[model samples]
Target: MWSAPTTTAALLTHVVRGAEEAGYNGLMVALTRNADASAQLNELSEEWTSVHDVTGQLIAVLSPDPEVRTAKIRYPIVYECAAMHDLRLVPPEDHDFGFNRCFVGSVHGDQLRGRAEAVPPRPPQEHRNAWTEAASRCASYFGITEAQIPAVLLLSFAERTAVLIRLRPRSADSLYDLCKQVAADLGWTKRAAELSARQRALRQRQHHLHRVVDRPELSRAKWRSRSADRLGSRMTDELRAQYDGLDRHLSSIAEVNPALVQQWRARLAELRSHGTVEETYRQLFAIRRHVIAPQDRQKWRRLAAKVGKVIAATDRVILGRYTQFWNLDDADPITAELRRQEAEMGRQGAEMDRTATEARQELRQIDDELNSVAAELGDIKPKHDSEPGLAAATEAAARHMLGQIDTDTVDGSAGLAGYTVRVVRPMAEAPVEHIDNSLSGTVFGPMVQAGHIAGGVHIHQHGLWARMRRWFS
Candidate 1:
């Protein structure tokens, strides 16, 4: 049987209270790889949040045992951590939202540790007020109004930026209105602009839209010239020279025949159409090495040998090619080398085929063993539902899985307000140096109802999604 709720009463009470106050009354499951963590320090922020976890909480939380109960997470802080995740985390097994779980713990892939635990706590009113004052001071020092403060404020002291997440579960107005209201609530009035933006000094842009321009479309011949220019740019000088020589020599020989001229042009166009110029040249070069070069060597040998047939054939031939090119002598040295290489390739291919066959047979045997084990273990129902440890094991094996320490972890014993004295410290004389303050944030309106907060922490308010964008960044 599981232990009583008092073990985590303080952890549970704080998160549910904070989340409800923020209008996130929905049930949530918190998982972590923090098997040894009770508090998570943002390493960068040096912010300490307290955490409470049962030894093996993940499976225990999802267990269907009657003794199992819901474990509310530490709020606000965990949500900030969650926002860092690009995708939502769902455990391998279906969640028992009806208090079927009692614990949570560490998980690596599908493997579950002993039990589950959660972390986090929100900043209290006074700390919240202190944060507001600091932000106001930053805006004033910079000579900008509260509405003009960037979405992200990078202080001079801390290595990490201070992202202000104002969760106004109570307000429904534009982000601009919320900023103005926030300033008013803080007893300050200094807003220089309407919206947040990240300015970039260097950017590429299209030519002037209204001006007329003179430009002619390229013809096929122009494309061919363009191809040569591109080839020189892409390849080394020696390679381009070698290719140019080949093209000139081939053109001189092929000029004698109209058919040869057409064939050469078509080949050049095809080679130029795709891939790098060096790669295309290699295809033509390989044909010369493996085919043409050997033939020329044999012709030279035969001519030196004073063979009547070779001399007579040369007189009749058009530049020793343009027809005699495909005519192979079978005795070419490259031909002999290719035959030897083919025999070696055949043996390697046969060995690969045998290994593939053996692998297929081994896979079949493994499949049979797996089916046998699955049939035997399928009968156990209680283990699947009662024990989170087993469910984590089986579900992990099935597929998928793992999340954050929560708010209470941040609050520890002190409230969120007491957590930090002053978060907005300026560098030198500048109020805040914004690294990037673009409006790239994706805003989501109330996923749940918004009546939870009667009046907002600010006048017009922001919600969870906005809070995520602020803190997660």
Candidate 2:
């Protein structure tokens, strides 16, 4: 389906032949201005003359170079003639097609035309190497070692300062070890004197061991404040504004009920600092039960439960490891095997907690759906119950009519006279229609005999009264 020819002429010839085989009326031929493409000029002349009698059109592409080199070069030429005997070329000044890249040569009815333009060159490798070398030298000048240069460049200066703690020389004398013995001894003595002087200056300020009694109340309040501050600062401006609004809402509540924020902060702080594992659980549950509304209580309860489970699971992991060690205390032969088993269980406990949390979330979603369905049912009750009211009325009317019916002769024919009178009473008794009359025509005709009505006309009389009452109501 595709071919890469050695020469532009060979490629163009192939393209032309392929186009002709494919039944094309026009051919777009592209050419490069090199020795490889020189053969193309002759090929194109031959193809043009051969196809002169044919119906197809031929177009040639050329580079912009006036003095074309053997390598890759493209530029515009101005001295080329426009009119010739065999083939005439029309040259246009300042064409959008730049000679720096590639140009087109069109041949149709002995008219040959070519246009050239310049193409943009790629940046050389020497420039990139120079920039990289400069950047590396600058990085080294700022105390960044070759090994740490990449991290220093990517992370902030504060982060770099923190990492520098590990990079500090454990002993200043170690650097001098590479020197001569006398020089090393002299350097070590000088460093010791300097360190002694520095320590003396620092010792004058305060005692090394002093109790740092942070007020318990202040510490707890700071925890919530810092957490909220971190949450806001990490967000974008739009989200920060939303958090600001929440903070304002809390501030307003704090102004009205100063204990509201204090209570939560105090409880949280106590849990974080002094409260035992079990004490924290009790405090959290107490908050959920007393402070939060019932509807919101479940979420807090779930959070507390999840946290408790995680803590307990972590403690179990440690306890399980300790149990393994205890078993190994009595048996030396399988100590390594027991320890491995303990490690395996500890790892699995964390994994199991993760799986349990995911399953809990899924069940919570199901619970929410069920609650929603119950609420929807409550909303649908009135409408669902109202639909059957008319049917009940119709059934009561039919029952009353059948009960009141008496075989009485009016004039020469035998007929029921009390049926219509009983219909009014049933209508008064049941507000909805009788169920029998609401049935199909065939069902109503049978019900007329069953009801002992004065023909089928009065069989549906109660139905009309029920419908009228419903319409008015």
Number of the predicted model whose lDDT against the real structure is largest: 2
* TM-score for each model: 0.17, 0.14
Model 1 C-alpha lDDT versus the unseen true structure: 0.29
Candidate models: Cα lDDT each: 0.29, 0.30
Query: Which one is best on TM-score?
Result: 1
Candidate 1: segments with Cα more than 4 A from true spot: 1-39, 42-263, 268-283, 286-341, 345-350, 362-473
What TM-score does model 2 achieve against the real structure?
A: 0.14
Encode model 1's per-residue lDDT on 1-473: one tens digit a residue: 01112122223333323222222111122111121111211210122111122111111111111111222454222332332232233222224532212112111111111112232122233222223323333334223334423222211111111122221122221222222232232221111110000001001011211111211222234334433443424444434444455455445555345585456546655654544443443344343443235345343332212222222232122111111222234445334434544565466657755655665565555556555544544544433334322212222221210111111112112222222211221222336766653345576664323444565555444788789888989
Q: Which ten residues in a row have the lowest lDDT in candidate 1?
A: 193-202
| Model 2 lDDT tens row, 50-75 | 32222111111111111221234222
